[model samples]
Target chain A: MRKAFALIVVLVAIGSAVPVILHWWPMAPDISADGHLIDQQMASTMVEVGSAFLLAQFLLAYFVYRSADRGTHENIRSIPGGVKLAVFVAVAFVGAELLALGMQGQRAWAIQYFSTPDPNAMTIQAQAGQFAYYFRYPGLDGKLGATHPEKINEGDQNFFGLDLEKDVAARDDVVSAELAIPVNRQIRLLLHTKDVGHSFYVPELRVQQDFVPGLDLMVHFTATKVGKYEIVCTQLCGMGHHSMRAYLRVMPQAEFDDWLKQKASEQ
Target chain B: MRFKIACAATMALLVFPSGVWAGTITGKVKVDGPTPKRKVIDMSKEPACAKEYSPTDPPRMESTITGPNNALVDVVVYISAGANDEGVMPSQVVTIDQKGCRYIRHITAIHTNQKIKITNSDPAIHNVHPLAEANREWNQSQTPGAAPLDAKFAEAEFIPVKCNIHPWMHGYIAVLKTNHYSVTDGSGGFSLKDLPPGKYTVTAWHETLGTQTQQVIIGGANETKTISFTFKGKAY
Candidate 1:
């Protein structure tokens, strides 16, 4: 019965590792231009972690099988190098793995956050409220208008609270629920929250950032592919958190220009 | 017969000037100055709602609705003081429907602890958010064909409710302690009935034009007192 139990444990361990080893369910495809660096870092971490997990499980199974006693008494013995070797291996392996991961991860993080956006990158502002996201683009003047919280009358669809009648810059701001960008062109996004805390998450772009109530956060990325992707809120802000989502459309330069022109005309 | 005697006694009570009878207060709310033009709402983002309106005719903002002769609509009139029974919640439920991405009633009145049934009648989804200061603030989303959302306010408050998904969709839920309240219709007419004979303060509140209060006295049973409120309007 003990042997059979040991056999079952080994079988279970193997079964669990098979799918992971075969790469059955991989991550969604990377569609961002600079996402390969982050993907590489993720892959390296997965390999290291997967190896450690398999090794630990196999070691556990071996210990269990060896410790199973027979009818006759047998003398117990310590491992070859005893406690010293075990401690040394644990510290050395863990320390090395962490150091490597941290170094590579720092590079990936620097590429996404540390570097400044390109000079010609298109700038847009995204405001997240209770359950919806509104994107604003500067019109002909290329200047964003000032936002007045008190002037925000949603009934008139003055969502950004721009004093268009008073503020010259506000008169040309174009607001939309969908985010449209030119493919292969860098875009810088300024994130603001109208009320409580919320997050902007785009899985395809490998971009996620929280919208702190008082702080203004920014993220920049270039989409390599031209398609429609989903931009969802990750933070639990309010009752409509589950349905808080918008479409991110990446189109060709001419198409994006036409879309912006049409939107501007409506405004 | 016992039935004849009861009927006679009831008839006597109705005929006699009993001090226990309730009265009604009817009034009209009007604006004194020029009314602001309602801005056209751009519902282009919500295609489903935009399709509900003709391309040439879109829904305008209903914040400051005014009719001919400066009659104000969507104004809430309620007894602010001198109520015999305070915090008496009604048994019936008040409903607010979201249709075509707009609140069916611009202003809804309910007593404290009275159940409010919010229904989403449109094909698209909507999030009902009430920004209540005295009462607890809450937000809820309802999808198409989903069950109605139930809510109740614990305190009296003038709460502004809006759909976060459709920012242009806005309404008000006035939670009052007394059941004697009325919302002005298109003709700026409101009637608060079943109000006991007493000296009470009647207040009228508009979403944009602000609020006005007047002290009124109900003389006797079956008496209908009339009152009028005039609010100053802003050009902008």
Candidate 2:
């Protein structure tokens, strides 16, 4: 019975690790230039964590099998180097593993958050509200207008609350429901919120940022592939959070230019 | 014979002595001042909607829709006071259709516990967001060809409904305790029927021009009372 029990434990461990070993249900394909670093960091963490889990489970199974007898009183046996060696292994191995992961992970983080965007990067503003996201591009003037909360009226579709009559700079702003960008070009997105907290998340771009109320945030990334991806809100903003989604279309440079020109003309 | 009797009964209810069975209040809403200049909405972001309108005749903001003769449209007139059956819920469903990326009716009124069926008629997806202050606020998304979304408000409050996807699509839903309400038409005409003989207060509400109320007294069931509301407008 003890042998059967240990065999069952071993089988369960193997079964649990099968998915990770076979790479089923992995992260979405990395489409951003800097996403490879994050993928590498994830791989290393998985390796370390997976080994630790397997080792602990195997050791537990072995102990249960060895102590299966209930009738006889046997002297307790310890590992070769006793408690000190166990403590030393835990402190040294686990600590070093964690430190290594942290040190390597910081590079991936810095590349995304610490480094400044290129000077020629296209700048766009993304505003998140209760249940929708709107993207605004500075029109021919290459300047964004000021936003007024009190003047914001969804009825008139003055979503950004720009005073077009008074603010000359706001007259040419091109707002769209979709985020269209040129492939292989760096993008600097300035994020803001109208009412409450919201987040911007694009799995393919490996980008996720929160829009804190009253605080404007910015994130920069470059998409290497030309395709359409869905941008979903991760924050529990309101009743409309679940339905809040927009499309991100990464197009060629010429196509993007034409699209912008067409939008401007429509305005 | 039974069908003939039913038809006769309905006709009798419709065309009886003018005031013997129940009284009705009829009125028109007028703008007291000059109409406000509407701003042209730029729907270029949403090409589907933008294509629906011509460049020469773009869609204009509908905050204040005034018709000929200073007639005020989309004004919700209701019995604010002296309503006897305040808790009676209506059994009929009120529908608000999202067609051409715009709410078909700018203003709609429903009694408490009544169902509101929202249908999306445009090709593009739409999210109906009702920002209710007193009642529970909710947002629902309906894709093209999807089933209509149903909702109900338990409290009496005015809700501003907007489509998050199409920012310009906005409307209002007025949830009232009593079923005695009417929305003015393009000619500013409105009628509230089947009112018991009593003294009541009628209130008219406009999205941008604010609200006005008047005291009315219905003497008998056949009496037809006339009450008019005039709202002051600005040229913003």
Candidate 3:
């Protein structure tokens, strides 16, 4: 029974660790041009963390097996370093892992967040509400008209509430339910929330950004693939949070231009 | 003299059908007690709706609209029982419009299986989400100038419809089995005319205020009966 117990512990540890180490269930394909760095960071962290986890599990199983023979309290003795040494080792080991992981992650985070968007990059506005997302593109003038929150009438199909009659710039703005962008073209997306805090997450694009109410935040990315991906809200804003989703379509430049034109016609 | 009497009787039958149009019920719904001040809607978020009203006369919340004489607007008064028209479907398509981000008619009473046509007259996009417990709920999105959306409720229910995109916008769609229903106008007046002579369980429903029922009886003669309901006022 003692031998069986030890075997079970070891088996459980290996059985749980192997599948994750090999990444048998991988993530969706990365479609963003800069997502490679993020993927590298993620892979490195998983490997490093997985090795530590395996080490701890193996040590636990080995101790359990060793103690099985010497069951009495008479054989239980303090280690050479005592409890103090164990605490120090734990702190040092965990602290080093965190510092290393954070440093590695900074490379991936900085490249996407720290750099300035190119002047010619397309600018799109993304607005998050209780249960839906709407995207607006700057039309031919390459400029977005000023937005008035008071003018937002969803019944009128005016989500942004731009005064199109008075604002010529707003008349050409194209709003779409889906976020469509040209592949390989840098897109500067301005994020705003109409109500509560919400997050925009797309696994394939390796992008997850939150919209802080009353504040406008920007995210820039260039998609490498041309396909449709799901853009879901990770924030639990309200009862309809689960249904708060939109589509992210990375299209060819010509197709994207035509889509924008069609949306503009709708406006 | 006999021929003249026959002509007069025939004209009376033509003007008012014998069993169908026996009597009419007319009434007003009044709210009792101290009225709560309505919250002025901050149209700063909606310039189009706001531009129409001034700072001193801003748009107010439509949850409980009150008028002079303690009048309650937007209440749905219908015959719940003792009416012969139960399960009779209405063929007329009731039209509702979304203008200035508000439902043009706050309360709509339609018979079960009656078509309700919803149109977007605003410049922005609007979505219709009906939270119905007795019937299958549905959601639809409409753009400006898009075609009207028509829907039907298969069962009787008081479904609350809202624009998820605009949280403040809300209205009610009352689907009843009987065609004898009337929604109170601005003056809190409602008249269910051409009701056949019968005892009716008249129910008055308010969105914020609970429902009240009063028994009304109509004689076989072409007479008009009066009734009224008053809901206890409370601050929301």
Top model number, TM-score? 1
lDDT of 3 at A7: 83
**lDDT (Cα, tens digit) per residue for candidate 3, span A138-164:** 888988989999998543456788886
lDDT of 1 by residue, A1-267 (tens): 766777787788789878877889886778898888878887898889978887887787787688777554565567678989989998999999999899989987987789999999999999998777889999999999999999987865688899876899988888887899999999999999999999988888888899999999889999999998888899998766886777889999999999899778666
Instruction: Give per-model TM-scores.
Output: 0.71, 0.69, 0.60
* lDDT of each residue in A34-114, candidate 2, tens digit only: 989988998999898998889888998898788787545665677777999889999999999999999999999998889
- The lowest-lDDT stretch of 10 consecutive residues in candidate 1 chain A is A70-79
Ranking by DockQ: 2, 1, 3
Question: What's the CA RMSD for each of the models?
Answer: 7.3, 8.4, 14.0
Candidate 1 regions exceeding 4 Å error are A1-6, A21-23, A59-79, A149-153, A156-158, A161-166, A265-267, B1-61, B64-94, B109-117, B122-158, B163-168, B174-205, B211-236
Q: Provide the overall lDDT of each model, using Cα atoms, as 2-decimal numbers.
A: 0.84, 0.84, 0.81
Candidate 1 TM-score versus the reference: 0.71
Model 2 lDDT tens row, B1-236 = 54553454345546764334477899999998876556566554456777888777777777788888999999999999866557777788899999878887878899988998999878888888899988888777788989999999989988999887677788899998888899999999999888766677899999988989998877665679998999988754
Between candidates 1 and 3, the lDDT winner:
1
Instruction: Provide the DockQ value for model 2.
Output: 0.27
Question: Per-model TM-score of chain A alone?
Answer: 0.90, 0.91, 0.95
Off by over 4 Å in 2: A61-72, A75-85, A265-267, B1-94, B98-102, B109-159, B162-169, B174-206, B209-236
Per-candidate DockQ vs. reference: 0.26, 0.27, 0.07
i-RMSD values for every candidate model: 3.3, 4.2, 12.2
| Model 1 clashing residue pairs (backbone) | none
Model 2 chain A — which ten-residue stretch has the worst lDDT? A70-79
Winner on lDDT between 2 and 3 is 2
Among incorrect, acceptable, medium and high, the docking class of model 2 is acceptable
